[model samples]
Target: MKVASFLEDVKFNSNKPSVLMLMDTDFSKELRVVFKKGQIMEDHQAPFAIVVQVIKGAIDFGANEELIQLNDGDLVSLKPHIVHNLSAAEDSVVRLTLSKADSLQRVKNV
Candidate 1:
């Protein structure tokens, strides 16, 4: 068995979001992403489905043309190729899970 603390041992970046990759395997990939207030992740699309959960603080999350405010304990999911973006409303920690192994492999090769 493996164990980790999503809230511990993280280093935040002032210039951009800090990403801590927790796991990557044939079925899924998990990441702990930390964002400082005012930082943003510009619009992007993933070829695979994804799940995002807010662990701490708040964020403005945009998917396609829809925008939603996310707070700690809130979770959201997106279909493949759906454009999405996010900005920190406050310093935040988010857990992102990518669910397509093949797509992740392609991304890693790029």
Candidate 2:
């Protein structure tokens, strides 16, 4: 049983946003992000699958070129190898859960 929390160190991201990694490991990675207006998460595709939950504020997710607005309480899963990007509409916070390669590969085979 291991527990982790946000780091005190401040890191700036796109649009002057900030971020924190609550947990990052070979098995699974968890991240907590704080987004400023106009902040964008550049386009990226992960080899492993991922789960994203909107913890606060609002965001728009572009998945496979399809756009959808996500508000608080929204949860979505990004399939392995899918092109995805994120942008914040307002000051927001989000949690990302990324699965390891081993687990993602099994799902791909099914």
User: What are the per-residue Cα lDDT tens digits for candidate 2 across 44-93?
Assistant: 77777789888777999899769999999798997788888888888678
What is the lDDT, from 0 to 100, of the residue 102 in candidate 2? Answer: 32
| lDDT on C-alpha atoms for all candidate structures | 0.83, 0.72
Q: Weakest 10 consecutive residues, lDDT, candidate 2? A: 101-110
Tell me how far candidate 2 lies from the true structure as C-alpha RMSD in angstroms. Answer: 6.3
Q: Residue 47 lDDT in model 1?
A: 78
Q: Evaluated with TM-score, which candidate comes out highest?
A: 1
Report per-prediction Cα RMSD to one decimal. Answer: 2.8, 6.3
State candidate 2's TM-score.
0.73
Across 1-110, the per-residue lDDT of candidate 1 in tens digits comes to: 55667898878887888876777756777878899999898888787788999999899999969999999999999888888898999999999887745344443322
